[model samples]
Target: MKHLLFLYLGVVSSFASDTRPLKERVNEFCQKHRSIAEIEKRHAEWIKQEPDNPDAYILPANALAKAAETVNIVAGDQKDAIAVLTDPKTGKQVGSIAEGPDPAIIKRAEDILKAATKKFPQRLDIHVGRMAMSQRIKDTEAVTTAALDLLATAAKDPQTLRWIDNEQIDGVPLKKALEEVEARIRWLYSFEKDETDKFAQDCALKALELAPGNVELLNFAAIRHLYRGEWKEGREYLLRAEIAAPRDWIVQHNIARASAELGDKADALKRLQAVIKAVPGTDDAKAAEASIKSLGLDVPK
Candidate 1:
């Protein structure tokens, strides 16, 4: 998904200038599935060739983000499983957990993004790169800061509405792209600070006002209410989400959770079972199973 976002960024950049040659090079590099080392080397050369160009920084930053994501996938999978290392001399076996990506790589990516943002403060792609890198590293503070920066930029850009009306990004409507940014802002605020609840709610409300039928934003609003222990309000929003997206497993899962939290065990179990039946072998189904077990109800086989 992040890779696709980077490609979309490339496409968007193409619209800004007649840099077809450079864009082609980037697309070629990405399509060839070059090693991170090769990508770093080529992107460094590009940066040296065009130190003032934002694309120089953006390309390498994206490559670095991809590298970070790849490493994280390996590390996360390893962390979920056990690995045993055997000593040659004493034949001793020791179990160890997998390590995360090298901090130096992440730092390098961040430095490139920071430098890009500093040089081209108005460029939305630079901030998006920063946000993606921050998320890869699980840096909540950095993510929130980047998200806020993105929101501020989008809000102030007069061309945003025009872009939404006419542009398409990776086959997604520009309006949906704007909604995605707004949704991310809401998500970031949810984790930012307790005092940011109002900010989160306001952002969600504003996003819904702009794109009222956005199920994800509606679900976010519902979760925010649930976070505040307002089950009735949460359920109301969830129902709205359901109306907007009836087959969305996440909405049903949240409804089940809300019901369980409200002491409606029978309803909770029924909703969870429905979710399981509707979306078997999915994350939501697994969550529903767990919720049922938490309620001391047997999952229907």
Candidate 2:
């Protein structure tokens, strides 16, 4: 009876120790069949087997997100027209409303990630994974919220943050991690929506609060002001950036541009000339020369 008990324990342990890559295991269900129902079934089985493994949650979330995107396309849901086509003579308009991702499917993906993060709050990878899904769906607010949450968590105890493999992210400096979040928020700004712009500002300000004198954040602030025609404010931010990274040619050039916009021609000209002189024969100098030409200021030659 003792030998039989040992044999049974060995068999159970062997099944529990899955040596295959986590992604490989999750992706197997997503392959060949690519059906959400089938994937969910397999996911349920995997979850039951490894309820404590974060991969069991995170990888399945990825698969579900992909499946949602696929279903949107396969169902012809993306073909709906955002604008109506009018028949002028008939005075009739016909069109389908713009269709986005299926909310229910996306919700499932988010819920799975939410459960994973709640269970493993220290897993930076899970947090970032959820943020990435939000980004894919163009949910700027959700992404912003997630980014802020990450910043707050990291600020509390950065040393405790861990990645997918359960190893501390100690190798990644806190500044670099903040910059990573900043980069994602910056990507949101490219959408050019007022909402995204506000979210970007919020994220940038929070990041700057944690990492003062960050030239990139300062530059982003300056550019945001420039976009709004706030020349003086833009120049102020750029000036701060210049103090932090005096050698950055882009900042020097932008400072000149902002001065020109603010009607400070002499100062702008002086700054432009300085940039051209400092980086002569480089692409940046070429850009400065072009700016001088556009401003009708004489090139230093």
Q: What lDDT score belongs to each candidate, Candidate 1 first?
A: 0.62, 0.69
- Any runs in candidate 2 off by more than 4 Å, and if so which? 1-19, 28-52, 71-103, 296-301
For model 2, residues 32-67, the per-residue Cα lDDT tens digits are 436678667766887798877665665556667666
Q: Which pairs of residues collide in candidate 2? A: none
Q: Which residue runs does candidate 1 get wrong by more than 4 Å?
A: 1-52, 60-84, 94-100, 114-127, 157-173, 176-210, 227-229, 242-301
Cα TM-score per model: 0.53, 0.75
lDDT (10s digit) by residue, model 1, range 71-100: 222322355333546668887754445534
- Candidate 1: which pairs clash? none
Q: How many residue pairs clash in each candidate at the backbone level?
A: 0, 0
TM-score (C-alpha, index-matched) for candidate 1:
0.53
